[model samples]
Target chain A: MTTLATRRQAAPGGSTTSRPARSGASSVGRPGFAWALPATIFFALFALVPLAAVAVLSFTSWSGLGDPEFVGFENWETLIADPVMLKSLWLSLLFIVLGVVTQTPLSILLGVWAAGNQRNRAILSAIYFIPLLLSSAAISVLWRALLDPNFGIPGQLSWLFGDGNLLGTQSGAIGVLIFVGMWQFTPFHTLIYQGAAKGIPTVLYQAAAIDGAGTMRQFFAITLPQLRNTAITSIILMVVGGLTTFETVLILTNGGPGTDTTITAFYMYQEAFQSFDFGVGSAIALVLVVVATLISLVVVKVSGYDKMNSSLEGL
Target chain B: MKTRPNYAAGIGSFVWLLIVAIPLYVMISGTFQTREEFGDNGPLSFPSSFTLQNYADAITSGFGRYFLNTVVVTVGVVAIVLLLVPPLSYAIVRSRSRGASFVFRFFLLGLAIPAQAVIVPVFYLINAVGLYDNLLGIILPTAAFALPICTLILSGTMRDITGELYEAMAMDGASPARAFFRLVLPLSKGGISTIAVFSALQAWNGFLFPLILTQSESTRVVTLGLFNFQTQYGINIPGLLAAVTLSMVPVLLVYLFARRALVQGLMGAGGK
Candidate 1:
């Protein structure tokens, strides 16, 4: 606490008292606040103000063209009753569940494999990470072409899955979306887990091996517990990513064979931009924000995100 | 002390490689052949007649305009970020005042708010300000989103610079601003480049803002342009693949050069 206190007083350009021992002790008065002002103001205009605007607009009835009439809870009431909106929220949750279920184990296994000091680690890691380099738009287009019924991979190997494209049906489209989502993001989780695993001292593993602990035993006893925070981070990241998924749904299925894969973000985009129901759309967007914020707050509590920030703050 | 053959690990690697390579090969090979050849021969076959016609068509058919728009937006956002974030990071590092700390915390809090959540008001707000369908509209918000992580990385690296350096510079009668340029910026080159590549990548790959914010062809970026092109030329599979390949080539080159720095930066954020 004393160190923090003195550090506050020791800030370079703001103080007048003579503290020449500290590095920033110039005290020549250039106001560090001025340095941060432009970026801070930019953040205010773009992020802070727009967020507040969204909150306010959620209570109003407006088309994108005219004066917004104040309508108390009307938009909210409609959102609750709208089956499509409800379905969108449910589908978003399903995407998250599917993403976690399919991606987590594969990422963990890949992380463990990559953590080993193997001879071909560089090439192997790069190969696994190729999806990270491409845009979701590109990936969607590539997959869509590869799944085309007449000319795609499935069509070429016709006996395996029959003649129809996987993306042409409702359940198949959702399944493909989940599969592609996992394909793109699993490498990111692998990278995170590998990084966390690399930080573990190798001596612990070596000692455990000498004590006759097998690879699986060492992994269960040491690796999982050490990666708990990273796991939490990955979960939070995936949940947000899943909720905000737009490009894949947009390009691959367009929320189709008829609204089967429409997630909340895409639905909100449709309500506002395509349909011009700005009021209802704003309400939906606000609801999404509220849900995301609640989840993030829980994440901060459970995952020590604030504590991590504090420790990083000392730097 | 004896070791197993590890056939399982090798097989797993092979399976994962096949998973990544299949789609990549499909896309790349499609770019090299004519549409009829691509369709009749099937996607998995080797392009028997490799030609650059698909690339030529992709370029001549307004792909250059979208590519240039993406470059402008990406460069604009990265430039604004590099200019503003470093100074703010310097401020946060040099000052431990409550306001500074609060501001730093505020910036960190911004990470939790994905732009998707705010796109509703962001849309109207941009419209209100008459930036609708404009490239600057996208650049401003993208730069705002980029600031938090960039500041975090820069300030984290800046703090590693010794206090003695600043103290010595102070004794030499240098102003804080002079010390900033002469001392801090020079030392934090690694952090600066890391954020540069990271921000550029984010801006390049951005889809949502470009999708909603800019509706006109003049303001269209590559990500949105690819979607429109695919829709408009649904039958022209080879040309579509060529555009996708062109859109990714720049990022692939960047990744080859800065793979280590990017991994380290993302690792730093993850490790936290």
Candidate 2:
């Protein structure tokens, strides 16, 4: 291995370091920092710069008019004492938990089921993927119309939904949000699990069947364990997606029934855009960034995703 | 190849199919009915007669303009991503400098930064630069947010180009730029198409950036237009459903024609 490495390294133009080149194979071309400069600057200007500004702006008071005044933790202090802010955090947690809990299993089942090559499964999977074609805004709007107390499906099936006022109460509103979320996102995650399930080695399943395992037993012993990585990926997406959910709450509930569904993302939009309270909004935005970052960090650490960077050694 | 049917799994999936299909049936069927008929029949009822009036009403009520704006945004975003991400990905995969890896890590960290988290400052920055209420404002940030995932996918593809290929090109005395054009571009076609589809969908379906940055009807994207249509014509269920149906037509067309590429692109978003 070392000889092969040295031979590759000794090739002319292969070395980016200052070390003297050894005589051997012809030099190989390699890209330099110049190639990466454009995207780096662009990303810094749009994403990273604004990220820093969110932190700085969180310490000041601004309402989208006049100059911002430095207030030294004032926004943070206010948010610490604010009940809506606290409750919004709790609601955000609830959204994440519900999203993962509902989406993970359902998508896994649908995915594994669809992985079969049967003609019916193929047709049904295609239909299942249709929801993914619509925008979040469109899905929310469609659901809002479809859930109207007087005109929607609930009205038609009043026996199943008494009063048919699904989005008018706290629990009712949250349920609608979760149900809509599941409807919109399950297809995409199911696609993920489908891909993962398709990749599972067939030999493992054959061996399980030879052991006289039943369908449920083979699924529990083989399919569930094999889907672990895909589950983590899907769950992380759900968490991040749930944390930043804005469109559904905006169009469907509008944080209504008295802030019942005002998750942190929606509250930030309300404070910054509607109320023009940019400072407090920035404070909320910073909290969102911190929490998202922490969660991502923990997952990366636990999953050893960072160590996957060793693939770069081949360069 | 044959075994007993899995009744439990089959039953569960059939129930989920009902859950998925009923809403879609309502939305499509509702769009074909008149407003009074729709309201009287409720969302679940079959359409008594087919009418194009709801779709016509949706088009006349600024959806045409919104469609144009969304198309522009999608094209602009795809163009920018195509120009920027491939070269960046090439560098991350082939460059040996520590700075190159650092740049890669920077974007990796960016994968965790949700657009909503920095949206307030983005709004402020767009206003400061006089790009507020402009489509360009929406294009730049939307493309920027897309870079991280695109970079990851493209680099993963580019990395699969073996070291021997580079050496073969080097033996011909090709420069890095020459090697990139000749070697990287052709091989990474799959990755390029994936990113194009992914970014185009992002721009097409984008709601938050346009919602915060641009306000006027002239600049409204389809998603925001759907939003405003809902608020302005809250009681017009048929028209609203028609608008929702219209917004998905382009994607549905793509799904029909390019289903494999679209599905591969979306699954790439899972970072495999």
User: What is the DockQ for all candidates, taken in turn?
Assistant: 0.54, 0.66
Candidate 1 lDDT, B1-272, residue by residue in tens: 21555667678878888887888888899999998899899888998998899999988888899999999999999999999998898888886455677789889778767787788788888888999899999998898888887888888888898866775676677887888898898999998887887788788988888888889889999988888888898778899889989999987787778777766544435534
Q: Which candidate number has the best lDDT?
A: 2
- Clashes in model 1: which pairs? none
* TM-score for each of the candidates: 0.92, 0.95
Q: What is the TM-score of chain B alone in each candidate?
A: 0.95, 0.98
Which residue pairs in candidate 2 have backbone atoms (N, alpha carbon, C) closer than 3 angstroms, thus clashing?
A: A12-A27
Please write out the lDDT profile of model 1 over residues A1-315, one tens digit for every residue. 354456666666555553454434445523367788898999988888877888888899888877788998998999999999989989988998899889887888788778878779768888888788788888887777778778788888988878667887889999999989988888889998887789888888888889998777888888888777778778888888888888899888989888899889888989888898888888888888888888777876877766785544622
Candidate 2, residues B1-272: lDDT per residue as tens digits? Answer: 33889898889999999999999999999999999999888888878899999999999999999999999999999999999999999999888778899999899888889999899889988999999999999999999999999998899889899887787787678899999999999999988999999999999999999999998889999999999999999899999999999999999999889987788766655737
TM-score computed on alpha carbons, candidate 1: 0.92
User: What TM-score does each prediction get for chain A alone?
Assistant: 0.87, 0.90
